[model samples]
Target: MDLLRDVLKGQSAKVFFSVFMALIFANPALASGLASGTSELTAFKDWVWTLTGIFVFLFIIVQAVRAMMDQITWLEFALSIVKVVVVGGCITVVTWAMGVFGVAP
Candidate 1:
């Protein structure tokens, strides 16, 4: 499970873990009645993304602080921001693909 561990250690892992934990602990009844009880899924998705957004905000703040402190170069700070944006875009694309395939919640 080293691969999984590595994945979970990345910057976007906060988002991934929030989504993962929500799904893992999802209400069985709500999850089972997908057609009639979509509220649960929608709320869970929102919650996960909300948490992810908060974590992303925190990451940017930390990066900004580090840059201000000269711990990392300005170029490195810009690249980190780009990396975060790229990762977020990738997630958006993946979710879009899942929806297109009628596999998303």
Candidate 2:
């Protein structure tokens, strides 16, 4: 009975210390840096660049797929070109918008 009591008390002390440390170390302000308009804008811009690269890579892969399809017609090639152009234009527009909005660090 005494050993069981000691084990339970040790577990209770660990729980209490963990909770106390969590409260002591917690930072509520940075929980969502976007909410505070902090450094997360830099993170957002990095993500935008990463996504832009991914889209361009995917676009090239799609163009390659289109080229490999033996029965692909001129209209299909034209549509692929149009798709790439539209995506490029959209990326440019977003970058411009971000610049105008002062999303930079």
Candidate 3:
């Protein structure tokens, strides 16, 4: 359990750092003219999507760590399920909104 926890902690930290760097350093200009809506709104939506993906991926990793540690009880599993459902629903809603707004080409 200790070993699994240690590995997961290290890996999670690495993933978090990488995502943070990407968010901070990614080209702002790439978002410009890439979508059809106002540049500010398009950029905000893109950032939201990117951050959501990062968070979901991190949740999956943490759940795997829990499994590895034999710590996935019914409650834990249920919570994970809820997290996935909520994130997926949000993604769907945001995607539809973007389409309806003609934000993406």
Candidate 4:
């Protein structure tokens, strides 16, 4: 097509992102369309994320307090931080498992 030829020759691709084309692609076949009223969902997700950020700060403070109180060594507190990071990294494994079991479809 002329459009493809134009793109291959480094012409503008704005035609692909025109309003009408964007609306169609944004809806796709998903039940929750990207262009739909998804702000409510995003708000919920953002709140949960905000809570988790606060939790991480509390966790670090608690760990540092324990080190000061001699309940745990500073090295042990560092190891606990590393452990938390490893657990966070494990989410990729769970994601991979879910995909293998067709949860994404």
Given candidate 3, what's the lDDT at residue 10?
A: 78
Task: Report how far off residue 83 is in candidate 3 (Å).
Answer: 3.1
Report the C-alpha lDDT of model 4 over 1-105, residue by residue, as the tens digit.
977787688765565567457685676443466544466566777898689778877998899999999999999999978977887678668878999999961
**Candidate 2 global CA lDDT score:** 0.72
* Better candidate number, 1 or 4, judged by TM-score: 1
* Residue runs of model 2 more than 4 Å from their true location after superposition: 1-36, 94-105
Any residue pairs clashing in model 1, and if so which?
Answer: none
lDDT by residue (63-89, candidate 3, tens digit) is 878877888875786689787998799
- Minimum summed lDDT over a 10-residue window in model 3 is located at 28-37
Which of candidates 1 and 3 reaches a greater lDDT? 1
Question: What is the Å distance of residue 102 in model 2 from its true position?
Answer: 9.6
Clashes of each: 0, 0, 0, 0
Local distance difference test, per candidate?
0.83, 0.72, 0.76, 0.76
Q: What's each prediction's TM-score?
A: 0.62, 0.43, 0.45, 0.49
Q: Which residue pairs clash within candidate 3?
A: none
lDDT of 1: 0.83
lDDT value, residue 9 of candidate 1: 80
Q: Judge candidate 4 against the unseen true structure and give its global Cα lDDT, from 0 to 1.
A: 0.76
